[model samples]
Target: MLDRAGYDRYLAAFNARDYDGVADFYVDPPHMEFFGIVITSRQELKDFYAWLHDNVEENVRVLNFAASETCTAIDAIVRITAKKDLTRAALDAKGATGFFPITAGVVQEIRQFIFYTTRGGRIEKVECALPPMALETV
Candidate 1:
């Protein structure tokens, strides 16, 4: 069974932008699905995170969470501040508003639903659902 403390630790690690710490919560070769893109290897996951860290600054606030014997689901609001201009294609792919141009330092809030399946107390698989971006005027 997934414990709340364990989940909290994961969240804390993630919010700290500690990729290595976050990776420790997952099994090697973890499976992840995000915005219809599937990442099956740990190396790929690390690379993806590296790219994200380089592109934007982000923080997540969990609004709700539920856990069962094998699965945990989290509903969160992710605030992202772009460090560079985001292309329309990239915005559209993430279900974000494509009409508004995303320039540097623009904050975008994304409602996210994330589900995790665990084995031996480590995350085995992750599936994430992201809605369209809601840009907040600073």
Candidate 2:
């Protein structure tokens, strides 16, 4: 089970772009589902973030959080600064789920609900979703 302290550390690692530290919080075969795209292993998670980092800088700020023995749920604001233009067509072609129009040097913010299922203090699965009307200029 992941407690609040552990989850906080995970967020810190992520916000710092410590990819290996972030991966260490997950199980060996962790599952991640972002919208319709799915990542079923830790290596894929690392690769996905690496690719995403190349295109944009992302930071997540938690608005609310709750944790139980098995699950952790979070409401957060995700801020993304585009390092290079990411067009809708290009993202679609690459199956990059949960991404929107991003013009180089522009910033966008959106609200999301993220859930993680934990086992033995490591994340076993993660799922994320947007609230209706989630996108707004910051």
Could you tell me which residue pairs clash in candidate 2? 1-121
lDDT of 2: 0.87
**Which of the numbered candidates is closest to the native, going by highest TM-score?**
2
Question: What lDDT score goes with residue 6 in model 1?
Answer: 89
Q: Show pairs that collide, candidate 1.
A: none
Cα lDDT listed for each candidate: 0.77, 0.87
Write candidate 2's Cα lDDT for 27-127 as tens digits: 89888878556788878888888888889999999999998888999999999999999998878776775578789999889999999998888899998
Candidate 2: segments with Cα more than 4 A from true spot: none
Residue 15 in candidate 2, Cα distance off native in Å: 1.3
Instruction: Give the C-alpha miss distance for residue 41 in model 2, angstroms.
Output: 1.6
